[model samples]
Target: MSESVVADFVGHFFAAGVRGEPPTGRIVLSQRRLVLAADEVKETIPLSSVFDVKVGQVPAEMEGYFNDTITIAYRVDDERRVAAVEGSDTNIDRFGTVLFKVLLNGTTALVRHPARLGGRVTDADAEKASLKLEHGSLTFKRKSGPFTVDLGTVISVERADRDLGNGPHPVVTFRHIEDGTAATSEVGIDSARKTNLLGRYIRLRYADVQEELADVSLDEEELEVLVALYSAGEGVSLSAVVDIDPQPLTLLLNGLAEKGIVVDTETGTKLTAKGRVVVGQRLESVNT
Candidate 1:
């Protein structure tokens, strides 16, 4: 094991299948191994054994304090195991972020913290993603919130065309699965190489099939219209999409209604859930 210290987070580690109480272990990540030490009952897991890590809030409890959960799943002796730990929401997150980057460093160039490779994130409102990429996951953090994703379960990553109205910004989408369904996030890519390479890497690594497309196909105009409706998120005026000529735009919008991607609401036009999924590829194509 490498002697260099990376990140060490102290917390109560709830080991899987253990007969006794949860151990107060310091989750330590060195160059080679991830160690959980509580008193003398230390369990050292090789980094290569790590398969995935899931981080999320675990139903806030007690009127006073609550913490997030970090679930680490690994393969051992051809058997899979899981351990979940809870701590200061912030520290628990560091546990996942640092460990993931270190493991991925073996395959990619992410030695220093990734804040330098700045990226923009659009979640409700546009912000910075303090983005960090690991071999098997990616994390986004900001003053408002933090998000962590397991790339192994990621289904798709794609670069979106620039929207002149929005800005000449190159966007990238990262879609992953939860509860057996797919979800996606859109973020701005400052570096062309980073966006394309990350997409190719995640898709090649996780997706079961080699092809990137679903069955549906749309021309540039059709795709653009759907993308517009998705951007509205709720019912909005058709003119918001494009009014190059009201006659042609209305004709196309109504055409999409037949496809069930859009509906003529009293307020204006809005995208149906199905339309958001299939046609919104204009939006993460919009999502499920």
Candidate 2:
């Protein structure tokens, strides 16, 4: 690979994977691991565990655009993960070459550069509905329905123009992670940027999900308890929540109070500052 490619490969990059357009983030190479990162997510895998690596492309609609793509599939114990990140047409070859060399070397290297600004997405539909990102899941909800998708289950993210003979316009499609499955959704956001944004956001956040959770403090039952108290004004009895029967709720409350996620008074329970912060993440999840 050329020196320019090597230089560019080491630092932060604007990477667009299977999703819409590119979201800004960086990839880190270490002696033992490879890390892919974005604003809200970080995925790291052992070099020995990475069994597959390839450079390829998805078809491009326009003539001049580069179709260069880099994809990786790796295992963490019994779990497997795959990611595809694309580079621009002019630089794709170099980017892949440099990365391949480093990984092939099988040695640790350290490089650092200030992160550059990456693409961002905004949507009007997001204003009408609530969109949240959490625990490797992306959820979009309205009165019509609350649609939740796991990032690990994502197949592909695409922005293209198709002609069914009637007309041609840009559309963004998200596919399922399962084989032989069609796209989960294919709708045109108002603009290309907005469409790209949603897809990138999902991919970036998905990287951070752990295959097996080991922390009891942040477990689902505990989070639900905080959310329940956050939603309930002043306080509500454990009997009010249907998700957990009273016995389990009773067991959970002791831990929640100890962690300061909630405050229990003689009459009822409420969220503490820490608890409110955790619950507030429910909305920030979409903002990402």
Candidate 3:
């Protein structure tokens, strides 16, 4: 309660035995806890005790009553409990973001935004930034602005090396799409523990996106074409690269295009951003 407040909002808190009548109250989020105070009720949930925080969804028990909601799952005295709060869409989203940062505060990293673009290394300067993770995004908060990477648009994340102020350090590099162009960013966490934690969370989200493509099967030839386009960048001759006839390569490209994996551009046939994600996973699996 004494810690600095991260976010404060007027919202509705849902608890058991309320029978669709939740309490309208002040929702307070601090560095260490979340406090919901109403006229007749006050509930405090410690940040450390929270095991999961979900945004844009309410528990089944509290559904229909609230649409824009954040559900907090925590434990108290060895008992698991769930609480839901309803607020404006923006406030609910802000609460989820703030909660994620509060739980992982003090995680600093050297960030290079647009470290690479379209398979080419960039000259962007590396700077110190605070890390903030959400379900769909990874953000680096710098004085200039927050550089956010949309997980849905991510093509690949890999371990790499970068010189961040000192000597060469291990860093997590992400390749994704920005403004319809392939882009990359790098983050060198200050410690091993922080790097591992951040990587784990990011890969979990990446896995979810990968899972959605599970049903789309690709044969060896198709896979070859994808990998070729990924490696060759744009203006790749699919027929020559895959050792297939031009007619068959046209069919293959059409198939991939239909699957939303590749597209023809002004330069040539290229892997769509999603196509890069697909090939990146396949390549990672092969390399490891």
Best of the candidates, TM-score: 3
**Candidate 1: pairs in clash:** 280-283, 280-285, 280-286, 281-285, 282-285
User: Compared with the true structure, what per-residue lDDT tens digits does model 3 show for residues 1-288?
Assistant: 678898999999975334567889999999889888888778889877776666566788777678878787777887988889988878887776677777666677888888877667888889889877766787789988987887877767788777866789988887776765567788887775456556655665676677767867899888978888776755556566667888888988999999988888878887665776777666656856
Ranking by TM-score: 3, 1, 2
Residue-level lDDT of model 1, residues 101-180, one tens digit each, is 66543232111111111132323545555666764566666556666666654545676664323466666565654322
Tell me the lDDT of candidate 1.
0.57
**lDDT: the better of candidates 1 and 3:** 3
Error (Å) of candidate 2 at residue 45 is 2.6
Q: Is candidate 1 or candidate 2 better by TM-score?
A: 1
Q: In candidate 2, what are the lDDT values of residues 16-42, reduced to their tens digit?
A: 232454444666555456666776656
Assess every candidate by TM-score: 0.41, 0.27, 0.55
Provide the clash count, candidate 2.
Answer: 2
Total clashes in model 3, counting residue pairs 3 or more apart in sequence or in different chains: 0
Name the 10 consecutive residues with the lowest summed lDDT in model 2.
Answer: 109-118
Off by over 4 Å in 1: 57-67, 106-288
Superior by lDDT: candidate 1 or candidate 2: 1
Local error of candidate 1 at residue 230 (angstroms): 10
